[model samples]
Target: MTASLQGQMMDMPLTVSALLAHAARFYGTVEIVSRRIEGDWHRYTYRECERRAKRLAQALIALGVEPGERVATFAWNGYRHLETYYGTAGFGAVCHTINPRLFPEQIAFIINHAQDRYVLFDITFAPLVDRLAPQCPQVRGWIALTDDAHRPDMRTPVSSYETLLAPHDGAFDWPRIDERSASYLCYTSGTTGHPKGALYTHRSTVLHAYGAALPNALGLSARDVVMPVVPMFHVNAWGIPHAGPLAGAKLVLPGKDLDGRSLYELMEAERVTFSAGVPTVWLGLLAYMKEAGARFSSLERMVIGGSACPPAMLRAFEDDYGVEVIHAWGMTEMSPLGSLVKLTGEERRRPPAEQRKLREKQGRAGFGVEMKIVGDGGRELPWDGVTFGDLHVRGPCVIDRYYRTDTSPLIDGWFPTGDVATLDADGCLHITDRSKDVIKSGGEWISSIDLENIAVAHPAVAEAACIALAHPRWNERPLLVVVKRPDAQVTREELLAFYADKVVKWWIPDDVVFVDELPHTATGKLQKLTLREQWRDHVPPSARGDADCPLTDVSTDLNADHAGCVPPSDRATRSPP
Candidate 1:
């Protein structure tokens, strides 16, 4: 075999600092706007942000932060948090972003697990910091991400973010570090157990930024104005911090105020052209737009992920508001940019309804990402679009294993995504459901996502979550839980009837329950686990030989445990004689 020859080229390491430096030097005048915790809008240029970030790097050094050390940040998406991202990682230390939305115990567990040296936070989280200080003894110091005057008076001695950077003259140089060294640390949401960290390296982070900014993925450019409504603490805000700067797009960060009104105002005030966030955030924005009868002036595109976007929401954005909806899918372990739903020239030539259907899928895998679906016994499934299987992916940006864990989660060099999905002949990825969330009835599978999407398509339904309820004859059946629009009326019979022709007769939900709102995780995903626990013993009206109940009645008979009682209606059609 011939020996592989290496090309003679410059061996400069790809580092996070390089992204910011390039932006500052070339896109110096590009604006980086942020809504501050002080209830005011702050604006700066990439050049100035780079200078302050350099000063922050020097400040960390003075505080005895060494290379490979972990500096934690509990902050919202803003300029200071952006500075923390580059400053800590640029100095060869790991920037650990902690989600403040998690419970106090979970936050303390993560801080201790990471053994973070210093904790920096926005002023909005001062109260939370005080509660967590005693629990996280490894956190050496707490730095408030605010100026001297607005610094919170906490029980523990805290330093001001501005004060720390004031002494440094922004003359420090970013040291050359190995590209494989750890750059960032982010933990999972920990819905099942304690959250595990997914540590990112400099090489992988840089490659992810490049791939995400590609023409097919985010398609970011210097002319675009980008706002990431996704929290900075969540998967690095879907990697916008790095990709936006790499594309030289102007950034607008909405700090701490993610409500519909605040986000709409910010988007209008700044003339944001492109934005990214989970479906829940966009739902709130859509609701507000309907109430105020407003339309977007400058917004052009929106990237929706974190959960399956209801078909109705997709139509609302593209058809009603004239904004392109880019449905995306990924996990925390994949550097969170696996696949994006964008139509091709061939696909776009079809009718609008057909194009919408293509966009309904998760789209094709992004560059550098390879994906496949496997059935039972590890057998690879064919891309026929009808068969569903476990979705797995492998890529340069994907994690080899979790941080601090000895065992690798990869199967045959590919990471199992824990999603049941299908791929069409054209290689479009369609996520059907989470592996744990798929409902099995009489040895047949039903996609909860499909049911939920159809349920939310009803005009009166605001949000809907379909969960598997314990059943006697069928093993388990889907029970629809819905939240209705304010002042809108919808009955249980009406909703169940609405699903008549949309899906298979057997796939329709057995019963419906109205709730004030469905519970969501910190990252804006529907909490199906919580819903299952809440309705573990719920008896469907079908099983009780009763007609469909009222939607306004929020009561359920938890003591009805008759699993052997098969309704005559179900037996006549579905049961074997």
Candidate 2:
């Protein structure tokens, strides 16, 4: 005999449209604010946002966009971009957010590969659109994300977003879309090869939004004022767009202005209670606050992602500014929400020193995320808190295959995350290094992330990176590259002594090299590949054992006038990024 399950439940589809509908129905008066590209504040309510989004949907249908077709957007984090997100995906069209920070050729390649039918962009990107339109022949039209008054002249036939929505009266009916239908498409930054698309479905996105709002994650709510400094083009701004509406939080978008002063002014004016961005943005803000003697009155929680948050940074915020720093980790392939570094009740009960140790990790996986580590030959590694291995994850939001690719990127239903990490029995995860960034010296593996973090903790060092260089005795050795803070005077011996107390001697970098600046990715990740190539030929002093070779004295004073003592062979080519 078969047991029957309850059948009285309502069949509501878990689509993005449903989220916006819920916001409009329950929190119609919730404010959605935007600092427009025109250098002014634009305010609206959830009800108005839904109305405009519906009108935009009608405009898209009038433009001949069909179900499953792709509509690309080149804009920042603003109200118009948010409208594009809901408008395209609400009526069944896939919203493809393009990263305008990528090289022009990469942009052209992505547009052509996605086969986008129409491109909607902000006025700031109109010149870029004009240059890339001729290369993408499949694009049928372009729409500027602004009023006609602020539209820029372009070679392609362009229409203002205001004009497109003005003809409709919010009368369009949204079709019942399958929850598994594709809703959004984003590409990886392509550090190694060509960029690959990660397509996300309506169910995955909505579920991710729900998981993000969990108390262990962002903890979003109706009373919070949220600001997302991460661009909307990057992994849906780490899923803030959907989570904000789902939780009915007031959103403040900074359009085309990400300077420290600008962000601080906006946050102070709006009384932002929660904000999310990369570490570089936060570093700039910390510098601004220090320079101007400012403080955060309303901001209680700050989510730092896109890269690891250094322990020094975490200390700076919590110890000095009275802010709770939530260190997060994710990727474009994971719907961009993997884990958040939050303390558990048991962990928080420990001494303050022990709590700081726990906060140094990337943290346990968020709700709906499953993670494990595997060694060579696909052997499962024990969660002993010390055994590092290849990181793999599986969840409702993780991608199984890249877009338009016939090959699957999974092994036995788990996706390899291309990171080397360790997990403890308590479910805490520590990211040691990326798979490619790990250095193999002699027979031991060295974590560049550890060295970089320790170096940046020095009062004189502003930023740091570690890369592998050729060695005579060891197959490779770690080299520290650094940028000094203004008026900093620290010797190599001082830094080495600092590390002697913190790490094993073998783990310390063999030599220290100072640079005016380090190369960084558009997302603020250190460009180790470029750094490796630039210094591949430099002969380390350890390999040569030549005391005569020009080397910076460990006892010499470091000042702005000091030209770095470089080896004779490499002196000519050494320059800034």
Candidate 3:
């Protein structure tokens, strides 16, 4: 290679703006498609996306969005969200993605906590904005990201996003971003106290996008029509929005509506080769496809995360519908990418069942990531499948702290993910416990995952969430909440008895509450803390495994036990979802 070319490659500081420059110059005509609003599709080339993103930058700058300022976006996976990804960061501002799934109060708290200066939100969230605007402090401007979906002529002033860029030059001179400048911030899926922010750099985001598109990562390319079902407000849609451009891939944005029908219709119509979402979204789509007696002919693979990917779900998609479900895991601290379960050269030749089993693990750490398990005393533990410990990761992309904020939980430069995991001989990581969700009983740690997995194993159970309660004898005990399937009858005792052969005697949940539905977080994770707050005090005295038992509806009983939003504890008294 020429000396000048080699120096250029070596000295190049990878940044989101730099990636856009490359894509804009090299592959401008590559398509970036999206299902705008719902049921409707819009197509824009990568060049156009970059151009519009530049206009957006011009608009932000014209609106006085200074460097180091926080620009918040309350949006889903869509074109506007994608534009904000580049536009905000392209001009050296931080994009604070407010999770639409977070409760309105939490949403308000995050906006206030981040001290966002300007807000750009999808029209679908206007009601939430109306409810939350009073609490937001730093916000001086609000831009509505819609043409008609959720717009209204309100007395409060908010400019239209697209209209703001109407007069601005589509040609933009992207600022030379500083390496240390914070490019984006996505809060953790806070199951505990207030959500902690993980600040990502222009460098880290660029590197992450590169890693995500590698064959060993999400394996993206220009030919693939990609849809990131993971919300845009969450970890840059798992980094696919930028990754698509960096890798020259076609992107499909499923705007605000992520229902199964909408997603499936888009997938088939767009000929989406790859997609990613949580298990709940995939499970819903699979169910919908099966009900309609249809499947995607062009659909290839899906990367599942934000939660565990069940072995059965993966197997069904592969065998029944011919889709490969790759399980990936990461945290907000780690630029949202820790590992992907891509098969190796040797593993690819393995039997289908064996390959499926290996893919179910969280997979090994990626190129830029470092992993170690720390035991109770904080010593580094070995990667033995049986020895589950607190998983700690440190890397270039991993955040050292929240930007311009104090969250005491961040420890020792390594963000405590509050997740417990086990790594096997092959470097495959399997999540065994979520820190708070793990039940500690009689001095032994119990994986609530074990209980929840077993609970879901019951044919009649639709969903299950297990939480710990303070017990007089043991430090804490477990309570299981079962959401029954449609027209299915499952007594608490029957459900508990189903777990007899699965887990150890002492590890079984002490109480099973048969509610119509289990509480879920915005990301579709079971909200165990909510369950703990409801059922922690009053224990169901009756044993759950007995076959000959009368099912008492605990909905009324639990309401009497607690004055507030009580979790339905009655075995037969399922509440409306």
**lDDT (Cα atoms) of all candidates against the true structure:** 0.89, 0.87, 0.78
Better of 2 and 3 by lDDT: 2
Q: For candidate 2, what is the lDDT?
A: 0.87
Q: What lDDT does model 3 reach?
A: 0.78
Candidate number achieving the greatest lDDT relative to the actual structure:
1
Candidate 2: list runs displaced more than 4 Å: 1-8, 546-577
**Per-prediction TM-score:** 0.95, 0.93, 0.88
RMSD of 3: 8.1
Stretches of candidate 3 off by over 4 Å are 1-10, 147-151, 349-353, 406-413, 470-476, 540-577
Best-to-worst ranking by TM-score? 1, 2, 3
Residue 87's lDDT in candidate 1: 96
Clashes of each: 0, 0, 3
Q: On residues 1-577, what C-alpha lDDT tens digit does candidate 3 reach at each position?
A: 6666444455545667887777778889877777676446788887888889999999999988888889999887778788888899988988999888787778887888888998998776777777787788579988898754456565457888878888897776887667777899888777767887888888899889888889989998878889888888887788888888888888888887778898998888889999999888886787688779987889999998988776667777888988877789987778898998988999999997788768878898888887777775566666757676787888898877765566545456565667888777888888878776677654456778767777775768767888886765456667788888778898877876787687655566667788877778877787777887878576533233233321123323432423222234321111100
Considering TM-score, which of the candidate structures 2 and 3 is the better prediction for this target?
2
Candidate 3, residue 263: how far the Cα is off, in Å: 1.1
What does candidate 1's lDDT look like per residue over 460-484, in tens digits?
A: 9999999998877567788999999
Cα deviation of 451 in candidate 2 (Å)? 0.5
Cα error, candidate 3, residue 478 (Å): 3.3
Candidate ranking under lDDT, highest first, comes to 1, 2, 3
